[model samples]
Target: MTAKHAFHLALLVVFMMVAPARAEDLRAVMEADNARWLAAYNANTPAAFPAMYAKDAVLLPPGSQPVNGNEAIGKFWEARLKPGDKKDHTFEIVSIHQDGKYAYQVARWTVVVVKDAGERTRFSGNTVRIFERQPDGGWLTKVHIFNADK
Candidate 1:
């Protein structure tokens, strides 16, 4: 092939390789996802939270059984939001990383709860969320893993 044609083809390849990952733009999407999590907590609703996860998502806590699937996760949060169960809660996002079709977020979360006998308990944990891109151009959690930082 001619030298001009070869140079043009090379340039096209370089542009295509760099186009998909606009590094600065991913932060916004990550921020929005982090905000969504906090909103779900404030509303005490599991629907939106679990919807952020894939259908076969898996949640691994620091010291507990794995919570599998959207339904079970929804049920767990619904119960946690019941009266005399939990009160004030907040989540602080620490960092987010985006690469191709996957991303991870780290955050610290705190919550106050009341027991059946009216005793109060306060706890906090560091959480890491792993997300995968969906076919519809949305992101969903493929794995939710966290540990108690205290």
Candidate 2:
């Protein structure tokens, strides 16, 4: 084979080897982000919640106006999550697709909220979240929208 052809073949082989590795790295980052989210929720501190999102994040919860910005999101959670509210939440990642600096994830979530009075309410839903890679090489949710299953 010509030297030019050999060089092209080697480059192709290198790309094939690197592509899957990059994808795996991205998946790992996304999984870590999910874990962090679960931890933040379980921590039950509204102050700890907004750090999981970008400064310009928007949250679209069912039947509520969109909550924009990190501060607003934090306040929203603080208002709804009372001090004695017990929450058990779990997330199952359905799919995650990445493009350049952004990724969208479809996940199924189940949450059980037990009030101070021992009343339990269960909420299960599907959520789609758009995550942007921050300048510091961390992923944060940019847009989060979820609806409950009736």
Candidate 3:
């Protein structure tokens, strides 16, 4: 092979080796993020979430108006969530993929919400989260949408 062809072949081999590792890393990072997200939500700390998102992030929740921007999203959640509201929650990541500078995660989520008025309800649903790769090489949620299963 010519020098150029040899260089291209080596690059291809490197990519072949790196791609699987990237997939593994994505899964681990997504799992860690899921844990953080659930902890924040169950803690009733709406203020804790906006920083996990991009400045222009949007949150599309079920049976509610679309929440725009990181700040608005935080406020929207704050209005509905109270301390001791969430009794339990889980995020079961179904699939995750990264393309270039974006990664998307599909997860099955469940939560048991407890009301101060002595009401409890369990909800389970699916969520799709799109994360944008940041300049610091971290990921921030750019778009997050979740709906409860009827």
Q: Pick the candidate with the highest TM-score.
A: 2
Candidate 2, overall lDDT?
Answer: 0.88
The global C-alpha lDDT for each of the candidates, from Candidate 1 onward, is 0.78, 0.88, 0.90
lDDT (Cα, tens digit) per residue for candidate 2, span 49-125:
78988999999999999999988998887787767778898888888888989998899999998988899999999
- Which candidate model has the greater lDDT, 1 or 2? 2
- Report the candidate with higher TM-score, 2 versus 3: 2
lDDT top scorer: 3
Candidate 2, after superposition: displacement of residue 83 in Å?
A: 2.4
How much does candidate 1 score in TM-score? Answer: 0.70
Q: What is the lDDT of residue 4 in candidate 1?
A: 100
Please say which candidate is ahead in TM-score: 1 or 3.
Answer: 3
- Candidate 1, residues 33-62, lDDT tens digits: the string is 777876777666777777888889898877
Q: How accurate is candidate 1 locally (lDDT)?
A: 0.78
TM-score, every prediction:
0.70, 0.86, 0.85
Off by over 4 Å in 1: 1-21, 84-88, 112-122
In angstroms, the error of model 3 at 139 is 0.8
